[model samples]
Target: DAGITQSPRYKITETGRQVTLMCHQTWSHSYMFWYRQDLGHGLRLIYYSAAADITDKGEVPDGYVVSRSKTENFPLTLESATRSQTSVYFCASGAGSLTDTQYFGPGTRLTVL
Candidate 1:
């Protein structure tokens, strides 16, 4: 598991419930990111953490939360998920440097009904 992996590759749930998608990377990269992709819209960053306890909100952080207390795991939680939140989630990681390239995990497709 030297690369990143996402759990529950597919999910379907009703609105107003909370759902958490797990992300794990064995590379021990210092930077982790969460993003959501929707039809007609490219990936939008939800949150990112440079290191343990160093997290920041990205462009679309509303309704979503992330934590990175460990270097190899970053989980994204949708608090009170809504129909509007249905989208494909992706997890990515990179070294803690600007010159590093990010590696993406297989996406998780979530549908809210």
Candidate 2:
């Protein structure tokens, strides 16, 4: 695929369990990001990686972990899923340029019970 893609477009899980969302891109972009979209919060960045093995936390990083082991894959893991984490998760990638626009995947809607 030339663009990005996400897995488990819809997910349901019990609270306190771990869930991992997958993100893959073919463009080999240098920057990858994970964000969660909620009704009031809009888009909040959870984590991002500039390149392989270089990851950083974003605005809402608590209870979430991200790893970029390869240039084209960035996975986000929720260590202990909670009801508050229920939202739409989106994975995006972009070039290093500030002018570059991020390309978003379809998104994953997760619900925690």
Candidate 3:
């Protein structure tokens, strides 16, 4: 089973452009998360969802948007992508609650030029 996975393992785009990254899980996990990996910030949360149709902004959601319309999918969009948005984006899933152990995807490396 595909526990949790991400698409377009790698992406490249120009500044001001827009890009969408996809994440999927087969377990119908109750919680899903979006995060970006940077040099200093490390892995910082961008957004998250408690369940289908329920979403919330995380520590860093300024240049990104996310939606979870179904239990097994969560996608993130970089609206008007910026150079600083260049980072390895990761999608994670947790079975029970926010504090539960989360499994991470392989990650999508996005480059902005």
Evaluated with TM-score, which candidate comes out highest?
Answer: 3
Candidate 1 C-alpha lDDT tens digits along 1-113: 47999998999999999999999999988999998999788988899889988999998999998888788989999999999999999999998673478899999999999
lDDT of 3 at 52: 94
- Output the lDDT of residue 77, model 2: 96
Cα lDDT for residue 3, model 3? 87
**Each candidate's lDDT (Cα)?**
0.91, 0.93, 0.94
Measured with C-alpha atoms, the lDDT of residue 66 in candidate 2 is: 86
In each prediction, how many residue pairs overlap at the backbone (N, C-alpha, C within less than 3 A)? 0, 0, 0
lDDT of 2 at 70: 94
Q: Per-residue lDDT for 93 in model 1? A: 94
Q: Give one digit per residue, the lDDT tens place, for model 2 in 1-113.
A: 49999998999999999999999999999999999999988899999888999998899999998888899999999999999999999999998752379999999999999
Better-scoring candidate (lDDT), 1 or 3: 3
lDDT of 3 by residue, 8-95 (tens): 9999999999899999999988999999999988899999999998999999999888888889999999999999898999999999
Error of 3 at 69 (Å): 1.0
Q: Candidates 1 and 2: which is better by lDDT?
A: 2
Please give the lDDT score for candidate 3.
0.94
Greater TM-score among 2 and 3 belongs to 3
